[model samples]
Target chain A: MPEPLLARSALRAHVAPEIAAPAPGVVLRERTDLTLASVAAFKGREAELADAVRSAYGIELPTTPTRVAAGEVAFVWAGPGKWLATATGPVDFSTLPAAVADQSDGRSVLSVSGERARETLATLIAIDLHPRAFTSGDAALTHAASISVHLWQTDDAPTYEIAVFRSYAATLWRWLVHAGQSRGIDAKL
Target chain B: MRIACPHCGLRGVDEFAYFGDASVTRPAADAAETAFADYVYLRDNPAGAHRELWSHALGCQSWLVVTRDTRSHAIETVEAARDVALARTSEAQS
Candidate 1:
């Protein structure tokens, strides 16, 4: 039998000791526990796909750029008739009527929170992150430093989760660290 | 410049890629040579109120048809290309 492969973090080499220690203003952590999948509805079968997602995940499929959560499962609208489904535990995507592709290893999620989290993110994201404009549960598929990213707000603490392609994770980490430098960052992976 | 993406809301123009004129349509397989030449080589560089194609490369990744005034750089309207194509297909069928 072949040897089992071990999973390694995308930021393993880039996350230095100086960046990992706890800081006061901004807290950054890599979320490695969640399982991710890209779900795309078939043309002309959007309603069927939505129904299947609702029954299987106990959450409504978001038609707009928003995030909807039910229990441990959360769905963030990626594009028209497309969503990025994330769950902390195992999820059966087979029953869904749409096309589902595993993205657990294809992407990396980084969570940023704290008193100056919004300020730190402001330097990188071009869109408005103000509470009134982008409140909790809002999601956006935009770019940061010209690299494509899927960003979403989770709670009132103003915690934001950014998902980027696996290869760009290190570059994103560097950008986040630089952006949060003035505010101070507590980076942990 | 900013574009109001139908799916992702307003975003910077840098997030999108200009795909040129949206008025051009593919000719039939058995179309005349002149028709094919016009479709491939001929393009009208209108000075005002031009319909163009743009893809939201960084956001949502949706292709959009934007009607803009070339002289003033004012975007009159933006619609998803899929909807526009679907409408054309239905119109042709009808």
Candidate 2:
């Protein structure tokens, strides 16, 4: 039999011991245990797709630039009629009435939390990230440091998740490190 | 400058890419060569309010038709390109 495949982090080469240590100001963690898929409803069939998704995942599909989470599954609006669906476990979208493309290995997700999370992100992204402006469950399909990124606030602890194309993961990590340099980053690879 | 994306709310202009006049429509395939050339190469430089095509490249990735005052740099309205096209189709049908 052939050798089993190995899963490796996109930031494996960039993970330095000093950066990985638990710092006090900001906590950054890479999320690799997610099954991601891009879902796009066919023209005039958005309602049908939403209904199918609701029945399958028990969560409403966000029609705007927002995120709706039910248990471990979350649907983030990427554009008009388009959404990025993520789950901790495998989600079968085969029967859904929409175009679905698996993105599990195509994207990288990083979670930023703690007191300086918002400030650090504010320096990189152009959107208004204030607590009142961007509360929990709010998501945006914006860019960070010129890299297209999808950002969402998961909780009031102010934990934010930023997802970027896998190829840009290292660049995003560098930007995060630079942004959090003075503030102290607790990066967990 | 900022564009209030219909679906994404207000966003910086840098997040969007200009695609020129939204008023331009494709001519029929069997139309005259002169008409095809005009459609492909001609654009009117208007000083007043104009409808332009812009794509939100980094945010939401929606094509928008923005009606803006060229002289004042003020945006009067923004609509999704899909909706605008659909409306045009319905108008033509009706």
Q: Identify the CAPRI category of the predicted complex in candidate 1.
A: high
**Candidate 2 clashing pairs?**
none
For candidate 1, give the lDDT of residue A9: 84
- Stretches of candidate 1 above 4 Å error? A19-23
Once fitted onto the true fold, the runs of candidate 2 whose alpha carbons sit more than 4 angstroms away are A1-3, A17-23
Worst 10 residues of 1 chain A by lDDT: A15-24
Q: What is the TM-score of chain B in candidate 2?
A: 0.97
Estimated TM-score for each candidate = 0.97, 0.95
Candidate 1 accuracy as lDDT:
0.90
What CA root-mean-square deviation does each model show from the true structure? 1.4, 1.6
Residues A28-130, model 2: lDDT tens digits: 8899899889899998899999999898889889887789999888899888899989999877765779999988888999999988899989999999999
Q: Give the TM-score of candidate 2.
A: 0.95
- True-contact fraction in model 2 equals 0.97
- Residue A43 alpha-carbon offset, candidate 1, angstroms: 1.2
Cα lDDT of model 1 by residue, A25-115, tens digit: 8888899998899999988999998888788878999999999999899999999989999999988675688899989889999999998
